[model samples]
Structures are given as structure tokens and as C-alpha cells.
Target chain A: MKAKIGWTTNRLHSFAGITISLVALFCIPLLGSSYYDFLFSLALIYSMWALGYNFLLGYTGLLSFGHGAFFGLGAYTVAILVTKFSFKPFLPVIGIAVLATAFLGAVIGYLCVRYTEVYFALLTLAFSMFFYALVFKLYYWTGGSDGIGIRPPDLFGLRFSAIEYPAHYYYITLAFFLISVYIGWRIVNSPFGKALQAIRDNPLKAEAIGIPVRRYKWYAFIISTAYSGLAGALYAPLFGHVVPDLFHFLFAGEVLFATLLGGYTIFLGPIVGGIVFTVAKRYITAVTIYWPLVLGALLVAVTLFFPQGIVGTTYSLLRRKIGIKGGE
Target chain B: MLSGVIRPTHGKIYFMNKDITGLSPHKIVKMGVTRGFQLLCICSNLTTLDNVRIAILSHMGRIGRVFSPIDRDREAYEKALETLKTFGLDKKRNLLARDLPHGDKKLLDVAMAFALEPKLILLDEPTSGVSTSEKGKIMGTIEKVIREKGITALIVEHDMDVVFSYSDRILVMHEGRLIADGKPEEIKSDKKIESILLGVG
Candidate 1:
């Protein structure tokens, strides 16, 4: 219901803003080093996942710690199809990935959304760890901790290898990222999005107003996981490997951290947060083996000083400086 | 228990000749019964119109439409607009719920309940924090809307004057028990009810 800025002057500003950034993304592969392009592609993938994560954490106010399971499932689906069967079709693979995770998400979300706050978080964590163990311990089909490998295949019958693949995949990642953002924008601007925000703001009130809060959450969970799965599917080809680590709770924590860092309330926060995190992690790991310590310290700083998150704080400051009259 | 916000330890709830005991709040709403909170429960981040629009969307089961723009649901949007107009909130439709005054916030809460178009509504302290001068007006608006829509309501209020004036039938509670249930006149004349309400035992 924070619809004051939607599709108005605020909407046009954001539309133009995202368009400019996306246009910049189109130039990254042509202008930047392959390493930079690869890293940017990875950031884009993370943005997709973070956007999905925001649906629960930001919009619906349900914090999940098990989304890595969906991510892993997506990776595993692509890995299984491409490696085991040598499947080449890209769209079907994405479809399978989304469907698989949505099924899993629905089952898990049904159980988890019955609780709120810490209970919900713990439940999602428990379920995610369950998947981590499932993939880790299942040595036969999953190849144990070794995971499975994938290759950059012909996308819609247009083949590209090592040198050409980065650009091709970058474009692919960009396309999907744009699609995901468009879908998310449409969703949050819709009445469904309003209801989810309402539930986030006040679950009791949402229920009294006839929102089937749990059911809405279940649907949100499925949609969110489907997006995570799409990101995961994209991730597998980008890295050319699908490991059990993808399922690990640690990866789930990373997704959570990125969303939090970005400011969950702001529309573009997670995407910007993902890029920042990717850049920061890259530089930090190069200099120190204790990257976690550096990252943790940074997180603490952000929490202490910028609780609205990077994008959210920046937006608020900009609005205040410009004298725009609206509460975030 | 009837609205299913709370479960009775040792009793069954029936609505429209069906047992609704232990049904969830949503199920109760689906059965055409709804409730409003004692506190300001409207979504603070949304516009006044959006607060009601969300209720309408939930009622229509269109909250699952992820692809279509909600504004494109022009019929529903216009209906919500009309609803806001009825509540005199149309002029402030674009304003966020949190920005509304205390009296208006309370009105928005009632507006959301009305959006559900329920057969019956349970209002918990509908006028709790409004200024003394505005309480009657708020209640008046609610009663007028409810009567106009032909909806039944069970309101929990502490103000005896408002209760006597507004309610067609009355139920009084004391120490977690129903002390009296009857016409307002009958309640005023009852000795035990008088003793408890007026401290004139």
C-alpha cells in the first residue's frame, strides 16, 4: 500500500534509473575485462536471487533461511539435465527448475508460514539444512560433495565457447534479470503486492480484512523460490558446476545478508546490494583470508549507521535533500 | 470464538447453522464473518485507498495475480475508489495510511472491514483512542455505513452512552463472563447490571 510513488513521477524516475543501469550492463562485456564481465554476470545472478529473497523478507515480512535449497535444486536440475541427459533446450530447463523448486517451496512454506519471526526463520533454516544434508550425504545421484558439472551449451541453438560464452551468458543473465525485475515490479505494484505488504505491516489486520495470510504466504514462498530456482539455473551454467555447497545453509545466509545489506524495503536495494557484495567480496578475498571478519565488521557498521540499508538510506537522504514529502 | 480469533476452552461455535469452532480467521472471513482490531491496524505504508483496495483484492481472491498490474484491475480499483468516497477518504486516497490523523486512521480501519462486505463484523474497541469529541462522529459513520449495507455488527465498547445509543441489542461482560444480554432498556433497568456498570450496588 506504499503506493504513493508507484507509476507516477516516482515510477518514471525508477524506470529511467533501472534502464540506465541496464544499458550500462550491456556495455560491461564489450568494455570490461572478461574477469570483470564474469564477475558482473555473477552479480546479476545474485541480483536475481536477492530479488526473490526480498519477496519474503521485504514484501511479505517473512524471513526465510532455506532459499538455498531452491537454488541448489535449480542448479541440480540443470546439472542433471545437461550432464546426465545432455539436454540442450534452455527454456525447458528453466521451467523444470522453477517447477521443482515451487513444489518444494509450497510443501515447506505450508509448514513454515504457520509461525512468525524467529520461528519462521528457524523453520526455513532447518529445512534448508535438511536439503544440504540430503545432497551432501546422497553420494549416488548427487555425486556427494563433488556435485556435478555443466557446460555452456547452444542457447536456442546458438553455440558459444570460452571467449564468446561470457558475453553470451552475460546477455542471457541480463535478459533473465530484466524479466525477473519486470515481473517483480508488476507484482509489487499490483494488489497482490499490496496485500503482502499489508501482511508484513500487520498480520492480524491482514487476516481481519479477509486476507488468507498463510495461503498468500505459501503462494509468495512458491513464487520466491521459483525466482531463486531461475537464478540457480542461470548460476549453474555461469560457473559450469553445481556443487552441494549450493544447498548449504551458508549460501542461504549469504542470500539473506545481501538482501539485508541492500535495504529490503527499497525496490532496487537487493540488486544494488548484490553488486556491491560481489565487488566487496572479490576485493576482500584478494587481500585477506579473513574476509568474513572484514565482511562482519562492515555489516556491523551498516547496521549501526545505515539501518535503512545502502539504497534505502540513500533514497531517503536524496528525497529529504530535494524536499520530497513522503515517509518511507 | 465465532469470528475465530480466539478458541473457547470448552464450547463450540456455530454460524449460519454450521459449527465453526476452531476455524481459522480466514475461514471465518470466508464464511462471511470478519473482525477489526482494537488498535490502528491499517497498513501504514499504503495509501488510504490502497488499504481498502488490499482488502478488496483479498476478498476477490485476486491477490495471486502476479503478472497483471493491480491498477489494471480497473473495476476493482474504481470500486475501491467509490468505497473511499463513501467514507469521505477519496480526497485523501493517495495519502499513506500512517499520514492520516488518528480519527481518520480509525475510520480507515473500519473502511477496510467494510471492504470485506461481510455478513457480520466484530469490532474490538472501534473508538478506543479517538478524541472524546470525535468518538460519536466516528461511531455514527460506522453505524450509518453498516445500516446502509445491511450488515450486522458486534462491537465491544466501554462507553455506555455510545453503547445505549448505537447498539440494537447489548451484551455486557464482566471478569471474563457474560453478565447480561438484552435490549438496552432492559440492561439499564437490571439491578445487577446497574450495580456493575454504575457502581450503585
Candidate 2:
């Protein structure tokens, strides 16, 4: 009986917590500066990306070091469509980008997910670098490292100038980000999510329980990479360009680091991590020329002290005190 | 040999008159055979109930549900509860599996295998970590549940008393070769068993 109170209150507190974040997110446009819109837009995109990526790593127990390939693929597809073919309107481009990434992700994930630990990581890394090299070498089409500049697509025939793009794009990103969160929540609390978590916990046992472990991991990998593609699709118009650098292994590492920083165990941990990484990286670079050094030091500190990441550690501490537990 | 965790070098395993040789563990499980490890294999971080619930959900072909909240699946939870009630772990259903005592962890491991509702259950040291006093109780429960469900149990046990008391038939193997196969009383009186296994002349 007493435990029920604790669980209910914990659920209420959890509900309150996510609601507060949504409220904060919904009001960003009210601040209204182009810079605020742009910065928060990137943060929201990254958060959505991390949430999607976490399905493969956090829930499904597959560590992918090649996700940047899909992200870049999405961006490149959108950029090429807009810049070369003069593809108008926002929605179809993103849909196409998502499809492109999902199609490729399904291929790559099938081969990669069956391998555990280091083998899986290396194979994904290899695939990502291959994509990076392909774009880099195909200078004419991809525009190489110089990249292709992107013009904002018309929003269903409502043309918006570059000056007005940031604010409008921020709102679009916010909507998609909210949708991603809801979808992520639905997934993690579902039976499919339970099997993925079980696979993460014990593959042998999961299989013994009649779960097709390999197939489920592959599904998660496809879903995760598809998310990266969506984030990339959103990113290109905001940044006004797409580059082969987006597929670099370093970029994949950064995404992984950010997710870990927020704590992969909690559902919102990666979002927090993504937001913190984007905002902090910008400020840190502005403060010092050796920003990589600062970020590296921060990573070391976080790894040593807050290994569970911010939300994970805080949630656990809260649970310890209040008899609350389970994934946030 | 049955659930295909390890491939048999030279023999076929027939379950319900189907060729199940070298099939994947999940495939074998799908064919109505479940195996529990001697080493506890339950998801340690999840609640005790959830540990069993995974098997029940999988058995019910609900593991692929993407839009449904598992917590809202009252039927799954009820089934999980019933499985726990059989193993006497229902009271600790909310506690994390890792927090369970060694004996209870073993119980959870076996409990998960049984949750599959398989036609045959292969238990590898199901009571190895259990306390002396609790061993008989757990074995009694295991027997009762298996009998009630009409599932055949193939148990690998080091405890001679448990082997003697529980098994209707006994197969004695020495160095990968079957030496004796008979009813418990028949095997107990075999000369090779008397000389080699029991260390009695």
C-alpha cells in the first residue's frame, strides 16, 4: 500500500517534470530573437536526434558509431533536392530524406546489429566513414568540404525570406521535437521496448524467452538512424548548407557523448545532454580557443563523477530518497 | 540439445516429432521448449515481476507491440503475478531482480522459463543456489507446477537426494556416454553405478 503511494507520487512528479520542459519549449518563440530561435532550434533538433539514437544504444543494447552517415545522408538528400532540382515546399523533402535514411539504415543495421560490443561499433564506424569518403570524393555532386548551400523551402506555397526562416524553422523543429518525444515515450513503454531492454540486459535470456533478438535490434537501429535523418533534414535549412563533415566519425562520437552526458538510462537524459552539449559547446568555444580541451575535460569530469549522466543520477538520487524507481 | 544453446555434435533432438536440430534458441522456444540457466539470467535491473513478464509477453506474441503501454496490459501483469505466486515470489514482485537473494534469483530464473508455458522445460541447476531448507520447498513447487501444467521437466541437478526423490526415470552418463538408463530403483541397483558413480564396491 505504501509502495503504491511512492510509485504514484513518483509518476506525478515525473509527469510534472516533462510537462515543465514542454512548457519551456513551447514558449521559446515568445523570446523572439533570431539568434535565440536559431540556437534553441539546433538544441531541439539535437535532442530529437539523441532520443532517436538512444533506441539503438540505450534500449536495444547496440552501440553504433556510424549514425553520422545517416544524419549527413538526410541533410545531403534535402540539400541536393532543394539546391539542384529546385524542390519546393518543406514536408515532402523531409519525408523523402527520412525514407532515404530509413532505407539505408535497414541495410546497414541488418548486418551490424547481430555483432555484439566492439565488432558492432567498428562495423558501424566503417560504414559511416565510407559514406563520408563517398561524399568527399564526389566533389561535384556533394560540393565536397565546401558543401552545398541550402535555401529555405517554401512552407506549402507560403514563401518566407531567409531573414524570417529562423523563427519559423524554430517552430517547425519544436513541433517535430515534441512528436519525437511522444513517439519515443510510446516506444520505450511498449512491449517492443520491453523486449529491446531485455535484449540489452541479457541476449541469451531474451532469446530463451522466445524473443527474436537480432530482428528487434535491427528494427531499433533502423528507427534510430531514421531519426538522425530527420534531424539532418531539419538542420540543413537552418544552417543554410550541407557538408560531408556531417558524416565524420568525430561527429558520431559527439552525438554519443552528448547522449551519455545526459544519462542514457532515463528517456529524457539524452535531450538534456543534447541541449547542454549544444549550448555549452557554443559558450565554451566563445570563452576559449581551446574549446576541445575544455569539452574533453568536461567529459572526463562527467565520466568520473556523474557517470550516469545528469538526469539519470538525479533521478536515481531522488528515487533513493523517495522510494521512487524505474526509467524516467 | 533441446533448446539449441549448444549444438549437439552427432544427434538429433525431436520435440513433438519435429526436427529441431541446430535451430536458434528462440526458434526452439517457439516450438514449445524452454531452458533456464544454472547461472541466474534474469534482467537484474528490472523489477522481479518484469523479469517474468518478459517471458509471458513473448509467449503471448506481444513482444512486437509498439503503440501499447506494457504496464497497461493488465492480462500480462495478471499472468506474471500468477507465475510469481507459483514460485512464492509474488510479494517481492516490485523489487528489482538484482536485489533478490541468491536463492530467489535462481527461483526467478526458473520462474521465467516456466512462464513460457512450454511443453518441455530444461532446467540447469534450478536449485543450485537455494538454501538447504528451501530446496525441498522449491522442488515441491516446481513439481507441482509442472505436473499441473502437464509439462515434462528435464532437470540437471547435483543434489543426489533431489534426483532420487523427484525423477521417475534416471539416465546415468559417464564421459559423454550413456552408461545406464532405467527407473530410479533399477539404476540405483546397477553394478556400474555402484562401482563408479556412488564410489561403492
Candidate 3:
């Protein structure tokens, strides 16, 4: 336990940091670079996805290589609702997607949460691939390999024109991103979150001390996949497309890579990683066809030198050098 | 077997008037049969107080509260402090459990189980890894806690001295079959028990 810091020091420090970050995010689209706004919106979506992933990676200590299934599940649900079913409401479509993905997450998590390490990761991978196969085979409903296009649904009857939709969508994604961060922060600081960490540190010990290790892992799995679903739904209109590749293991690896790059342990690590990785990948691909090689090398470098990822290492260094208040 | 770590092949497990046979470890613990392992198994990264607070929180049914911050739970904090104080570990509550000395680590493990408010605690070699000089003090603290709380303690120990000193009744098992069940004095005076455990045949 840290020496009890003053209320002003503890609360004000994190509060001010959050305010500044939120303000910066709220104003990203106003920079007059429409292209930058588009990239930032994509980055924001991935950030939310990575934030979900962190629940498993950072707190619950489950390494899932199949979260792309939830993200893809979300994207396809919204795409199907819009294109096939002709659903028009924004919130309800996302709501249904969240509920559906959470349902699937619950089933899969119940099975996978009982295992750990490679077994847990592999089990999640199997389920994700199973989901990918399901969507790919149902060509009439899911568009199969042809994928599906998304028509931006009405936002409470105030529909934006094509020219302004991108800018408006940025704000919407930012709003959800802010909410996700706040809730994520709150959940991690809660007793449930501490219990998850305890399970991660020592499941046998956690069980002996009365923490239901497997059940809590399942809970974390549901929470994370729901967030993934939400991120995927939010991403549909932004990308204007849903594809089966989103559910593939490779895409899951990308999400995992971004999370590790940003700093999975620190609260905001995955968010930063998501933003940087998405934006960096876009630029890197445009620059070279050898993008995979470059990215793979970066992943290796980060894993070797910065195991805590970028934010975690920097937070520790700052705390050590200047004794700055990073966080608990 | 009583804590439901493994199923008992031959008998039922009735804890506090409930059939808790083959229940999950957490459910068994929730029913008031908490356990401590032979090895130190506290959540080592967390502070000593937080480790105890987690058990207290579980006992209080606050482990599932997602909205409330862990540190703000006054009842859990105070109760955890009380459990720590019982083992004389409150002074080192600020330190991480893994960083504690060997004896204190053993003490903290039992303290966490105590925090769960177990009606019956099953301790496996509670003083196993501690120095011989500190073993008596650790056992004394644990004995005091069990006595004060009126907890039915089932301590598994291999130390002859600890067994002779602490036990009221003794059961001797040879080759996985119970050979003796009686008061410690009776077991001490039994020729069969002396032949088996004491190797005085």
C-alpha cells in the first residue's frame, strides 16, 4: 500500500489527466484534417477493442487469441441488420449486437475459462475460428466471403449527409470511447477487478481464499467480449464494411499485438497502443509492401525490451526518476 | 477432502449441517470451511493488507461489487486489519506479502484464511517453512486466534512436538487406513500408535 497521499494529490492528479486526454480526444476532428479525423476514428474503434482485450490480458490473466470473433460478430450483426433486415436505428442495432455477442461470449467463456496458458488461448482460438466458419458458410445471411457493406443508420432521426457523416461519426465513436474508458477504469478499481487480479496472480490461492476463480474468469470474458461487440458495431459505419477477415485469427493477433505494444498492464496502455498501432499500420502499409516484416520486428522488439509495453515502461521510469505520480 | 479440493471416495462431507460433497473449492469455503495450503500461496504482488482484505471482502460478499472501489470499503478494511492484528502482522501490512520474511509469509497465509471467518479451518503445515526459532510463536498466534474465535481447527502437521503440544484428539493413519482415534494422551500411550508413528516397535 502506498503512503496515503492527499485527496487533492490522488484524485486531482488522475482527474486532471483524464480531463486532458478526453479533451484532446473530443477535439481530434476539429483539426481540419478530414483524413486525420478518419484515421483517428478508426484508431478510436481499435482502442475500444484493445481496452476490452485488456480485461483478459492485464487483469484476468487470460491470453485470448480469438477475440476477433466477438469484434467480427458485432460488425456482421450490424451489417446484417442494416443490409438484410433493413434495421435503421443506430442504438438498437448496436444493442442487439452487444447482447448477441455477449451471449456467445458467455457460452464460449464458460468452456475456455476453465483452462489457462496455452490451453486457454488455443481454446479461444478454436471457438473464434468456429465462429468465423459459421459466418463464412451462411452466404445468404452474412455475405460469406463477399463480405457486406454498411449503410449508416439514423441517429435518433437526425441523419447526417455523406459529406459530414465521417466527422459526426468521429464524435460518436469518441463518446463511446470515453464511456468505455470511464467504465473500464471504474471496473478495474472495483473489488471485482481486484478479485480478478487475485485470480490472475494465483488461482489456487484465490480459490482457497474463497474467490471463485473460474466463474470470475467467465465474468471477465463476458465483459470483454461485450466491449468487443460494442467496438465492432461502432466500427461498422466507420469502415462502411464488414468482412470475415475480422474474425480470423490473424486479425485477433493484430488486436493482441496492439495491446502489447501500448502497455497492457497500465490502465490506458492498450488504448494508446490501439491508437498508435492502427495509425502506424496505415502509414506503414502505404509506405511498403514489406509492412508485415516491419510490424513483426517491432512486436518482437517490444516484447523483448518493453515487456510492459510503451506506457507501462514509461510510467515506471517516470516514477523512478522524477518520482512523478503515474498511478497505483 | 473436507475443503472439496478432492472428492472423498468413501464418505459424505457435511459442513455446518450441509452436504458439501464434491462442491467447488470456493463454494466449500463460502460454506465456512476455509483452508490454508502447505506452501505460501498469498497473492504476492498485492500488499499484505490487500491480500487479507480480499479474503475479508469474499467473506463479506463484497467481492462481486464492480462499482465500489476496493479501498473505500471501510468495513472490509477494518475487518482485514483485525485479522492482520491477530497474527501480529498489522505492522507489516503495508509491505507486499512476497517481500515479508519467511515466518511472516506463513503467518499471513493463515491470517487470510482466518479473515474468511471460517467455522472450520483446515491448515496444512501452517508453520512448515518458518525457522525453528519462530515456529512456536507462529503456532501460538494461530492457536490463540482459533481459540478466541472458537474455530474448529484441523491442522495437518508432521512435527511430533507440535502434534503432542497442540492436539486435543489424534487420529493415526498407517498405509492410508485409520489405525487409531483417541485423545492425545490415549494415542501417546497406545503401543500400536507408538510402533507406527514413533517407530518404537
Candidate 4:
């Protein structure tokens, strides 16, 4: 048996990750213009969202087609707080948004966790669409299909809106992204995360051991929703608008696609995948309208050939080449 | 006393203080109870270590923060390894349970059950199809695990010799109704047990 504690390969990997992240943080601004900075921030935001989705789908082995509901709820909460209530400090607003979404997630997750696989996916999708319809019908609160326009707030009396710089907003987005990434990392590395993977692998055996599988799964779903909601909340300021499109199934599909592209086994895979996806969407949409078709084809190819996903497959190849075996 | 696998109706069972009477097989497993299937319920895709790890993880309190250290993971891994070692599976830890020979998989399944550390471990036909040479080793492992781990094990076995050898007490079920309960030697001499096994009672 491997020793419990040591300066193992995992430690080395963590060091490598930190070095790369620090280098990227310093280099991105130097090498690219403000436009690239903005796109990079957007990529980071989507990566967080996709990572959240991967938590439920990949780790817990539960498929949800309605996470857009949580995303939309977060966006709406932030929009309402900032636009109508005139909330100034971003932290409290973001906190309230996460809390509200977590509560919503708890309710939906309670209902959906009872089911598995396709049925669970369908249930979440139904609930999401139900909320979507409710938002559409409640025109006074939601502003109907047109969505509510949001203006960036002054952070501690420092007005980014007055400055009118994309770089300023990019920094704000980066802050949110980093925080969300850290929280997500903490969640996936926790003991709870291991239990969720066990549930995915063999739920029955999990229960027999005294782990409350349903409760754990419900908590997983809620956390995933809360994280996705945080992403949506950050998004309101990033785009300067909150729309019903945030709640659409298409948005959920995009996150799912990103998850598949990244591979859930490696923690950083989705982030890399999200960057690739955003760049592809940006460059492809500029030239062609049928971008979904192209993206769908690419996803199919990835699914068919690299089923373990880009990160998982690459990690396996690297491990084989390096003659490193077992968990890292 | 630990809860028995209570059958409230046909095609239904209640185990480990849960009303699993109408729950799906998987749901029943999720509820802190399970019956070892006739064919071992090991994941064919993963190694024996992975299988036991999954089983240990299934009973964890928090499923969301799985990658984080929870104080239980190390303990679980240690316990699982111990169970595997008890079953002589420590050497084959990296090998997939499915790829193992039938006898080894059976031993692995029992070890996997031990990894669950269940309050009541159910073993269905535990010694079935074992080679005569290996039956003693398998039975010895099962007996040792129950004693060492303090687990209440309920073994359902058709092999009369194996059953007679290890059971401190025996419960003979014929057509779902328990027909006898006594020490193994007492059960061996019972006319009812003989009649039931002969299909004439």
C-alpha cells in the first residue's frame, strides 16, 4: 500500500499547476489587447459554469438538462438587486444570489435526486422550463422576454462605468472567476466529492455502508446549482444585461458540451475546454451562422474517438509515456 | 439486534431499518443496505481497489465535496486494503475484479462487502461454484472478517459442508420462510433440515 503522506506526484502536479496559472496571469495582459482580456475573462466564467455542471454529471453520475434554471435565477437575482434595489457592494448581492439559487437548487434537487440518469435529466429540464415560463409570464418582475438591462456598479465608490474600460470589467470578472474556481476546487477535492464519485460508481454499495446516498446527491445538485448561479450572477455585470436566454436549454447544452470537451476526470480539463470552446464560437460565428452544427459535429467526433475527454485522454497518454501508474 | 432482511410483500424487502419494501434494487442499496447478488455486483470496468473504494465511498455523508479529504477516506482505504489482504486480494489490488477468475471474484465480492463495514452484511450463495480446494480458504476468510471486523454477517449458502463448517448459528430458509435456527451441529442432525434439503418436507 502507498504511504498515507509523502512528497508525491500529486504535490508535483499541484506545483506545476500553480506555476502555469501564475505565468498565465502575468502573460495574458502583456501578450494580448483588451479585447482578448475580455474574451479570456468570459472563458474563465464559462469554465466555472461548466465545472459546476461537471460536478453533478461526471462525479455524481447525474445528468441535469435544466441547470440553466439556476443560472437564470442567479442572473435575475443580481439584476434585481443592482438595478431595482440599488445595491452597491457586489459581495452581498452575489451572496444573496448564491443563497437564493441554492435554496431553489435544494428544492429542485430534492425532487430530481430521487430519479436517475435520463429520468433525472428530464425532471430537471421540466423544472427549468417551468421556471422559464414563470419568468416569461411574470412580466412585471422579470421584464418578460426582453430581460432587464443592468449597469455596472461602483466598487467601493470606484466607478468602472465612469471609466468605460473593458479591461476594468475584465479584472472584476477575473476576481469572481478565481473565487468560484477555488470554491469549486475545494468542493471536488473534499471527502464529499469522493462519496459522490462512489455513488456514481455503485450507489447500492454506498448505501450499504451507511452513506446517505440521496441526501449526498441532493447536496451535490444544490452545490452545482449554486456555483452555476454564481457564474450567472457575475455574468449580469459582465454583459451589462440579464436575459431569459440565460435560462434556456441551449445555455445548459453549451455547458454540457464544454464538460464533454474538457473531460471531468482532470479538474482543470473543463477550463481548458471552455477556453477552446469560447474561441471557437467567437471565430466560427463570425464566419458562419450554422455554428451549432459545426460544434455538434466536433462534439460527436470527440465523443466517438476520445470518450474519456480531452483532459482524461491526454492524462492517460502522458501517464503511459512517463511510466507513472495509479492515482495522482 | 440488527434488522433482518424483512420481506413485506413479494418482490420487496426491508433492510437495515429502512422501508425498502417498494424501492428499486439500486435505491435499496442507496438506503444503507444491500444483498450481495448471485453474481457479484462489482464494476467490471474498474480494478478491485476501485470497486472497494466505490463501495466505501457509497456510504459517505457528503457526496459533493468528494475530492476533498474528509477524514474518512484514509480510514476507508486502510480498512478496504485490510479486507482485501484478509481475502488474499492485496496482491491483485490493481487487477480488475471482473478479470479475476470466478473464485477470486467471489472472494473479492466478499472483501468488497467487508469494505462497506455494514452493520449487517448479507452474503448470498457465498461459496457457490468454488473449487473444493478453494472452498476452505474462502470460508476461512469470511469467518475471520466477521470476527475481526465485528460485522454481523448473514450468509446464504447451498453448500451444506461449508455452511456446517463456519456458521456459529444457522438459519435455513426454504421458499422464503426460515425453516430452522440452531447451532451448525444441531442443524446438521435436524430431520427438518434433511427433509428440506431433500425437497420432501
Q: Which candidate ranks first by TM-score, i.e. highest?
A: 2
**Per-residue accuracy of model 2 over B76-171 as CA lDDT, tens digit each:** 999999999999999999888888888788888889999999999999878887788989987898888888989999988767788888998888
lDDT, model 1? 0.84
lDDT of 4 by residue, B118-196 (tens): 6667788887777888888878877887898687778777888888788889988878688889998888899878987
User: Chain A alone, TM-score for each of the models?
Assistant: 0.94, 0.95, 0.95, 0.92
Off by over 4 Å in 3: A1-9, A161-163, A324-328, B182-195, B198-201
DockQ of 3: 0.63
**Candidate 2 residue-wise lDDT, A1-328, digit = tens:** 1112226656676567767777898788789688888889999888988888899888877788898899999999999999889996789999999999999999999889879999999999999999999999998789998999988888878776445767777888999988888888888878898888889889989999999989999999999989999999988988888888899988988889889999887677898899988988888988999999999999999989998998888777876998665643
**Which regions of candidate 1 fall more than 4 Å away from where they truly are?**
A1-7, A162-164, A325-328
Candidate 1 vs 2: which has more TM-score = 2
Native-vs-model 4 lDDT?
Answer: 0.73
Off by over 4 Å in 4: A1-7, A161-163, B1-7, B10-37, B42-84, B89-109, B115-120, B127-136, B148-151, B180-201
**Share of native interface contacts recovered by each model:** 0.79, 0.82, 0.79, 0.43
What lDDT score is found at residue B181 in candidate 4? 91
Off by over 4 Å in 2: A1-6, A161-163, B199-201
**Local accuracy of candidate 3 as per-residue lDDT tens digits, A1-328:** 1112323455655667767887898888789887887889889999999999999998888999899999999998899998989997989999999999999899999989989999999999998999899889988998889899877888899785324667888888888988888798788878898898888888888998888888999999999999999999988877788889999988999889989998887678899999999999999999999999999999999999999988888788876996665243
Q: Write the per-residue lDDT of candidate 1 for residues B1-201, one digit (tens) a residue.
A: 677778889878888899999988888888889887788888998778889988888788786676787878987888899888878889998788988999999989988888888998889899998888999889989999999999999999888878999999999888888989999999989988988888722
| DockQ, computed on Cα atoms, for candidate 2 | 0.72
Candidate 4 displacement at residue A104 in angstroms: 0.8
Model 1, backbone clash pairs (residues 3+ apart or across chains), number: 2
Please tell me how candidate 4 rates in CAPRI terms: acceptable
